[model samples]
Target: MNDIRVDIDPALLTHHVERLGELGELPGGGMARLQYDSSWAEAQDLVATWMREAGLRVRRDAVGNVFGRLPGTDDSRTILTGSHIDTVPEGGKYDGALGVLAGLAALRALAARDERPQISLEVVSLCEEESSRFQANFFGSRAMLGLVGQEEPRTLKDADGVTMAEAMVAVGLDPAAVATAKRDDVAAFVELHIEQGKVLESAGVDVGVVEVITGLIWEQVVVTGRQDHAGGTPMDDRLDAVQAAAEITAEITRHVAGADGAGRVTFGRWDVRPGWPSIVPGEVVLSMDLRHTDPADLRKRATEAREIAAAVAARRGVEVTFERLKDETPTRMDPWLRQALADAAAVCGATSMGLPSGAGHDSQLMGEHVPAAMLFVPSVEGRSHCKEEFTRPEDCVRGATVLATALHRLAY
Candidate 1:
């Protein structure tokens, strides 16, 4: 290991984060820079400028994944760091932004010393991870690994009916050149992000070295029942889709509660046809988001939940269907990388623990093709995907220092 001290300026990280936040400021006091949007374009430009200022070579791929390279003594392979920059709707400042900023800070700190690593260091602002605009997650990572299917650009659409291809072109990125985004030289990847859950904060831990990213099973459940006039039909005579959906939702929640150990189920979105007070709903479409660290448990829970939904629909005299939207298997972080992170945390005198990430990340996708690890800073109250999400600057600085130390060990 190199006898190097990891030093990062907290004010610099804060300044870069605040500047990125200005690009997509929401009235609700957070950010909303969805993929390929105008705000996303501007934010990418700002990051490009910062990378150039830091004496790194700045470049963007076809899908708009930005890379700032600090060349090393031997550039045979590169050590990749950073995270996605696109924000969720009403997302906090630190979620994805902090990872990118921290990567820059670490690289800049090394550059200031006129030091070069054995392997090149590249800080990436990945293009999409939240899927806020289109149903595309890990767009930038997939492009880097050549994992994106050819049909994806035409099939996915945003709320405004914009195809991903159109959005890419609108941002002056070539859609046809997506294949050029794949890289053969990334030796390893490390991402730093907010914990996005209350576990670290509740436990008073300064950092979390992730063991695994949870597997996710997203499904759309549709309950079909007969519509009846609210006034004319007796309660016993009506077969209500909304009631069946409610019962199934409650049952799913109960099942998840019984599973124990970081299992989660959310029925966040719903759509009811003929949404009028006078008419009973004939159809209800609700989304199910189930996650767990164990792949078998995740699949079992999904199957059981679907069966329960069926039983609930049968009891309510309704027909139900479960349409799976996306199913992602659990991914384990590299053990060596985890150890390096733990050692770095120890060096920084920061408390660290092994925790599973409850949320999805591009790291999971990147893990499919390369060795990937994630570092976590505390999220106050474990809240995320909302404006109320926050992580203290002290925690942020600690996380970044740990990241810097680990990157130094890997690259230098």
Candidate 2:
């Protein structure tokens, strides 16, 4: 076995995680550091301070994406790595933040290597990604890729009616200057993130080389039924929207379940109108999340799912509508970069496997505009998006060490 490794300062990395974890920590557990919020602002400033300490040029863009740059001798093009800084509501600590910290640690390690890279290297802390606060998912990455619409800032809103533009202004960012956030110099992007699934843990692998991000189909299914007094109407004479919606959702689950591991679906959000003790619900809406790795298969599955929903509603004497919320195609990682990451893992004495990411990530958007790849560390028990989510500290350090070695290989 041949191995050449790069070591990261564990103490320094642990300090970074611990200090930042405290900023948006909930009283009970987990984190909620949404973009442009006070906790988020504090965390961003703290990371920038650490970047300066690492001898990198630190700057926040128009939309609040923070970058720590180590300029190359040529300085014309750049290689970028890192993850978002924002967290999902009640999200675990490791998801996106680990990637940023790992990149920061890697850059710091490289800074001490006595030779600068041939191309500029940067570690980015993207501003908004989770969509936990606003409907503007991948806001930072989209801005960087020059994909943001002129009305996005003014139209995207949070639960509190706060427009993305208003939130930008609140953070001292001029929303009108968002166009300036676009960049054409990023040549390649790599993200190191927790797998957030059971793949690596079940396979007993140290890391995963992501093959592709799964394509997703999101829709709102609204079932309409006649409202009637629950106590006064005969059971056979009443049309219950909630009951019809429930049957449709159950059928969707069964359909995806029959696809084995090739497909998945979730009805995560629901609303029954005029919730009351004696009145049957007249309308119910269900938010549907669908996924598959193959584009054709995903489309076929989504179409079948819609048909199933309509059939279920018809059988229950109700009207249904399918409103598309999002439809994203699968993003394949750069093959060259995937191989590079695999080789880097071997160099660090860690086993690697090829896998697909089930969850959407900023890389899915970034890969559309630039060469992008991702690496995954194991998540304990496949837990994520909750307080119980965790990755072992040793695994964290090992993954970051592999990332540092990879950065050295690409940059040096």
Candidate 3:
């Protein structure tokens, strides 16, 4: 292990977390920092100010990805770090915020060094990853990878029926120039994030070196059935859309439950048209989220899920249609970067373990375009995505220190 150590300030890290957490805070506790919203815009501006305070050149991309760059003696390539800034509805503070702050602290410490690195380092506050406002998941990363379609901004709409292009204009971003956000200089990406699960906490490990991120499939299922009054339609003659949708979701759940603990499925969102209590529902829309680590297994399960839905719809005499919202293959972390992170944890006197991430992250998409790895700090009680989510100050600093150590090893 190298004898290099970066002095990560626990107080500073905690302070940043607390300050950022207050941006989109709700009346009860959690936040809703959706992309292009006012709260999100404020958070991005604050991060830019902090990046400037860290002595890094700051810039925002056409899609609103905020970057803080530290130049190197050899600036031909850059080592990228950080995470998304947007949050799921009612999300807790630490999920995506910690990674961006940790990267900021790491780069700040490295900037005070006497010697410069061969490669530049940048900390990015990715504009959107949670897809809370629109159906565009990984919008920031996709912009960098040049994967976002030209029509997306004009077509994708939010709950208020505002298009993504109008939202971009509201935030002073040019939807027409989104193609310019793509970069060819990033050589590697390292994101520091909370484990968001109990694997590390249960094993008493301080940090986790993520090996792979599970593949995911998002399907929007819409069921159509005859609308009839509850008094007029007999139970035997009624074609109930809600009944069919519920049955399909239940069957899909049972199938995943039997997949030996490696599969996951959730029917999280539901919408019923003509939602009167007495009405036999005319239409119902629901979301299906399926996940597995193996690509072929994921594909097989997705196909099975579709078949099950079809069978249920046919049996119930309701017409069903499915729209694929998102389909991402399993992504493996770069081997060398994973080892470097483990070694860095060892050097910092923190126990490390290799684990697969059950939750999807921006790294899953970033890994497909550049060499990418993730460092995970333990989340208390494995809680995440809720108001109770938390990580200790020491563990937060330890993870940041390890991130700094790894960057030193890779860039220096």
Candidate 4:
């Protein structure tokens, strides 16, 4: 296992990346291949074609997860690799796409070897992770883990008021059979991705072995107040919901910022009812996204956030309520698998280090069900989730080689 190594073609990786990056490119700038959209479907079909060219059998599950399989001598259990295929609205090219490409490249290299593995190897292009089009985050991984709610397909709607079920049907997928996507044969899983931060690049490292993934809490805060004409309502008499909401968000941000830089809070979305300059807003709806590496600290911050909102609302004479949209605890990677990835990096002559992932991923959900781990390459200038996001080509090839080497150790 220590001696295991696999060569990845740099040109092949570059070519696939350029082709995939072109699918959902937006007119203004970045890409947006939202889940089940036309561009997303086209990208999946292209990946399936690449899988077939790489000498693997390809199939799509009921939830639209595309898998490419290389059968082994003993096929009862499988080793799974790859990541989600979906991207955020106007998202960069490498975020989710690179992991899928790395897995494909790894499988391609392994296929040319003389000896077959003792367990099946499979790569998946998960249907959704960004939740850019719908609010169902990790929908693909949840289906595989048997965590998706039965009514989600009919209930979850996109920005355009289209239900997930309708979108699935449009893509020729039967939402009624979502349960069929569950799999119990996966023995282990590994995902290779870009760091999406400056951790590795700042340290001048070649790759990163993810030690843990941060916990996240998403809450929707809604404030209600009296509506009146902006000109007639006195500043002191007006119970402005937007003002209260803004204060609440500002207080939360201050608290998180004052703490060690490890904790993060964001008010990414907000809406003011009767959005007019001449109207005193009667209702305000805002999103609070909180994250921390420590589970206890994460919970503490969430509690503090709620308390702060309630206090501010009381003082401001407005009614505030919170709805918990999502809550995910911190996830630790499998130690043995982390060591394996580090060893693989060493074998591939790439420097490696351990770090925690601040962003959410399909791996966080998958790790709870299987022995899972992640490998991360550098993102130049720590830029991600935007058009300026980039990773050097050599770093990309090195990461793929490390992934292939790790797969060789586990599968063979």
Q: 148-265, model 1: which lDDT tens digit per residue?
A: 8876887889988889989988999888788889999998999999989888988888899999999998898889999889999999998999998999999989989998867899
lDDT of 3 by residue, 1-412 (tens): 4669777777888899999999999999888899999999999999999999989999999999999998988788999999999999988999889999999999999997888988999999999998889999899999999999988899999999999999999999999999999998999999999999999999999999999999999999999998999998899998999999999999989998997588889999999989999999999999999999999999999999989989998998989998999999999999999999998888889999999998899999999989999999999999998889999989999999999999999998
Task: State the weakest 10-residue window (summed lDDT) of model 2.
Answer: 1-10
Q: Write the per-residue lDDT of candidate 2 for residues 1-412, one digit (tens) a residue.
A: 2244678999899889888888899999999999889999998999999999999999999999999999998698899999999898999888899999999998998887778888999999999888788877688998998888877899888889999899889879999888889999998999999999998999999999999999888898889999999889899987899988988888889988898687889888898888888899999988998999899989988888889978887788999999997888899999988988899998988999999999988889889889999999999999999988888888888889988888777777
lDDT of model 1 at residue 14? 82
Instruction: Name every residue pair that clashes in candidate 4.
Output: none
**TM-scores of all candidate predictions against the true structure:** 0.98, 0.97, 0.97, 0.98
Off by over 4 Å in 2: 1-4
Q: Quote the positional error of residue 114 for candidate 4 in Å.
A: 1.6
lDDT score at residue 360, model 2, on the 0-100 scale = 87
For candidate 2, the TM-score is 0.97
Q: Could you tell me how far off, in angstroms, the CA of residue 91 lies in candidate 4 after the best superposition?
A: 0.8
lDDT (C-alpha, whole model) for all candidates: 0.90, 0.89, 0.93, 0.93
Per residue, candidate 4 scores C-alpha lDDT tens digits across 1-412 of 3587899878999999989999999988789999999999999999999999999999999999999999999899999999989998878999989999999999999987897988999999999998899988799999998888878899999989999999999999998999888889999989999999999988999999999999999999899988889999899999999999999999999999897787999999999998999999999998999999999999999999999999999999999999998899989999999999999999988999999999988889899989999999999999999988898888889999999999999988
Q: At residue 162, what lDDT does model 4 achieve?
A: 97
Taking the candidates one at a time, how many backbone clashes does each contain? 2, 0, 0, 0
**lDDT value for candidate 1?**
0.90
